[model samples]
Target: MKMADEGRRGEEDGGPGAVHQVFVVMESLLEKLKVLNYEEEILAKHNMKNLSRHYFVSSPFLAVNPGEQFFLFTVIAAWLINEAGRPFTAPQEHDEPNATVSNILSELRAFGVKVDFPPSKLKSGQESSPNYPAETTEEESVIEDDAELTLSKVEEEMIEEPDDEEENVMDLEALKLRTCPTDTEASSKPEEILEATVDAAEWSLEVERVLPQLKVTVRTDNKSYLDRLQEDVGKTLEKAKERYQQASGGVTERTRVLAEISEELEKVKQEMEEKGSSMSDGAPVVKIKQSLTKLKQEIIQMDVRIGVVEHTLLQAKLKEKSNMTRDMNATNLPEPATGPFA
Candidate 1:
């Protein structure tokens, strides 16, 4: 449990740049739990409290019940194992802690993740227990990668058209040869004199022959360009107007709707504030406590009354039995005497 506390301390002391690995694992586990619908599957079914984003994170300052944490850990681990296509018995509250941890670790290893920590570390249900979900996620990712590769191969085989970009690619070696001067051309004899090889008249004639081909004419028609620009602007404006109408119904209508929504929001906020204040006022709690006190007093009074009634019933039965016995003895003696005297 101190692992989470230590991570928080490190984050605080090391500034914003510090991140803890335990938190990362916990966050990943939380996401996996969400995917598994733990809210409905576990919490709601068991009538347990909803888990927090950092429910798995343990800190001494937080009053987290260790038994609850351990139970949640076992439940989530069993669920994740089942999700990973493995058969695992869900752990019960009476299950031995060490055995539960061992089973979870066994499942994690079955998923191909190494367990370096002892089972005791998992006893807290925070440090190492969350690793099971991460292992399942990794295995799923590997499976997805394999599936993707298979799909890619199938797509490649199904492709009927050649790639135009591949066909359009130019020969880099030919281009290099044309652009780069050869070693022989770059090298010159040490004793050779540097001179112009071409005649000026022939060069001038060759330049004139190629110059016409290089002289490009780009005609600019401002009227046509302006017309096209205006058309494009008009189309863009029309699209904007249509989108605006679809999105907002009109500016005035939108403003009125917004005002109504704002008014409703304010009312809701006020109601929420009032409820919050009432809940925090402790009146309900006081009333419940008073009711419990009154019930206890009533229970004590009922117990006294029941005891008195039972005692009175017992005395009355004893007295009636004594009176019947005396009457029986007197009747037997007198009947014998009257018969003899008569």
Candidate 2:
């Protein structure tokens, strides 16, 4: 949610510093991609360069799949910085925010890491009720401690002056007055309750304002990552399918070729045997043996190659079958404002 606002401001401002920062991010990403023999085919498919300018300026990543979008964001962030003519810099270090339960949950969602942050036990409809602040038993305990401190102070003051009987009696009455509710006090209870209710209503309105906007942020973030993954993996899956088919069909053809080679070897062996008994020199037989040996080795090598291809083909299919569900699940935020902090 916090990053969402920064992103918008970066686009609108588009100052030299902002552009430079973005170009640096994109350039850094491209460098990493180069190391991995990565190609920006996703950009080419969209008929656009995966530059930080257009991407940060707009949501072009959404048009692609998750991996592609992720590549664009993570890698392009560095490139944008470079393009803006800024010197390369590493991500700056800073202390993280206080580790509140809410902040932790939000970070998990942002990073697309799943961790269950279970909510505290609450009365039905209590969470949805706005007039009451979302607090746990711990908060109530804190308030109860303040109440006890107030009572202790009153008791000490009473103890400090009790030599005069009338004064002591008056003090007792005052203490009772402080402890017990009179008619006015009882009547004012409704006003206090009303004020509390109004406060809760305001809190509800605040949550309403923040939560939906956060929802939009989360959805867009998830969609961009997903789009890139789908595009990259989806393309690989398709290519794998084609390779699998070709490899599968080629296996039969290769086996037939091997059989033909075997038949030729047998014929050569027979000819060598028939000619061996009458041959003055063994050169013909030796030549036949060498050729047969080479042919047999070639068949063995062919089998190994086929086996490798089959394995590759199997892996591709499994990867293709793997859906984006688990990958996407990490971004699924716990029901808004319902975790421990909420």
Candidate 3:
């Protein structure tokens, strides 16, 4: 649990929100890469450019190919995993990003680094898990020892000795010589010491004479330019805010009306789509087409029947005319007698 808490703290400390400290993490990553011999193994082998300190850092100001960054991140991660005695396959350019990130996180967790962030954060190759290199254990200890020794040496050098000028300024030997009595003074000092001649009242009067001259006074200014400027700025800001409000008073109403219009349009569009779908699925059009086809077939049959009836009537008319002619020929003697009588 303690290790987990430490790992979480480490992750939070190195998280993206700490933008100022990202360089520290990047530097650590660069050191780890150097320890892995990336200069000879990765860059030289691939004929790639040297990695910058911010190579894996995501920044809006830095334009980089995300595909290349992700691939490089995967390659380095796989190499590190292999170096840590784990057999891991390096990802390719066309590999799924989520899968690659998951695999890397799995391997990182296998090394006991707790990862709580989502895989999407790693997709840009900006955030990398902390790497613990097995080969650097002894080297790190030795480096730390050397650093401690160097620090101790620096501290020892920082310890300053007393200067001759400071000793002269103190004059401790002179003070001691004046404080200790010599042999001649020790023998004659008891009766020959001088007594005070001046009065205490005179000394106090002289001190009072110079008291006003020794007193100091400081004057304080109440009017500050910064305070005046602040008041002016505040008034200007208030006037600007009032003017802005007046100019854009109808903005909220316009936005609400536009939103309402958009909602109505969306409703109308949905209704049209529903109507179109219903018409396409309905049977009325198909039934109407079938009805029209049946009527056409019935009209064609009626025309055929009318033609047959007309042909039969014409044949009967022709037969009647022929019979009439034959009857006139058979009765030719009666017709000649009538003509003679006429």
Candidate 4:
């Protein structure tokens, strides 16, 4: 968290250059210290803390480099891991074969280092001892009912086994339909478990060092951006209105044309019916049927046009809604009435 603290300070004070130098040095040190993952948490142990401090004082060779601060941090990280008696593969510039997490854990075990997840503090079951007490009868009934439902569902699925390869493919396709969290969610969980907070000073320094490469300037003038966003939203709103009107007109025209075609088809059918009745001929009936079929096809074509126009209008409405949301957010910002930039 020292890193995060330093970062925040750099932001508040505007002395980003100095903080960046410190962060780079610390990061370099961390890089040198092997086993920087969950194993780094072991540094709280007594042996590791002393060894870590000693290594920093003794390493005079890293005093003069452009990345000297980073170099120190790497050494510190290494000393902490060493003191904890955790096995860390000394960092190498080039990749090495046969180095794995299992291998390192085994090595640490040999050194008598305790390497495992921390003990959980979760309470026991419903019929609790010191923690949770027994549940009420109603609650117990609900739990039992839910358990039965779950068991039945599972049994049903198991009974319906994929006997054929085609069924197996279908099952796999169905499994893919469920939602899964992104990589961010997975990474965030570990930070919480480790109780890690980036020092503000270090964070600010790191951001300053890295942000320039990204070319994403922080929005300092809140009002200016709001004005720009509002202007953009207004334009989008206008465009959306125009598109909606055009779509409405197109749909109306198509609907009108379809109605006229339907009327014509009905009239043709009536004439054919009359001719057939007068002459006892089936030819007129067949001709009228064919004409009606052609008219139906024409109606279908007009319907497709109306459908396309409706889809376009829906998209325009969505765009208008998004623009309106942006406008609303802009209007909600307090006016910058008294400031140097204002």
Evaluated with TM-score, which candidate comes out highest? 1
After superposition, which runs of candidate 2 have C-alpha atoms over 4 Å from their true positions? 1-220, 280-342
Q: Residue 205 error for model 4, in Å?
A: 18
Clashes of 1: 0
**What is the Å distance of residue 115 in model 2 from its true position?**
36
Better of 2 and 3 by TM-score: 3
Better of 1 and 4 by TM-score: 1
lDDT of each candidate versus the true structure:
0.66, 0.45, 0.61, 0.45
Q: Write the per-residue lDDT of candidate 2 for residues 1-342, one digit (tens) a residue.
A: 001112434567876466344334434434543432234533454454544422322223424343344333323223323322333332211211111223323332333333332211011111221111111111222333445566677577668866654554445455545543246645666544344344664455345334533532222477888999999999999999999999989998999999999999999999988777659678888999999999999999999999999999999888766646656777785766777887
- Consecutive 10-residue window with the lowest summed lDDT within model 1: 1-10
Per-prediction TM-score: 0.37, 0.22, 0.33, 0.21
Residue 284 lDDT in candidate 2: 83
Q: Candidate 4 local accuracy as lDDT?
A: 0.45
Candidate 3 residue 189 Cα shift, in angstroms, is: 88
Clashes of each: 0, 36, 0, 32
The regions of model 1 sitting more than 4 angstroms off are 1-16, 19-21, 125-342
Question: Per-residue lDDT for 180-297 in model 4, tens only?
Answer: 1125445677444556687775455344434334544344688998999999999999999999999999999999999999999999999999877878967877999999999999
Model 3, span 56-153: residue lDDT tens: 55556667776777677677777666655568887776566666666776666555455555555455433343223212322333343445555555
Clashing pairs in 1: none
Name the regions of candidate 4 deviating beyond 4 angstroms: 1-220, 281-342
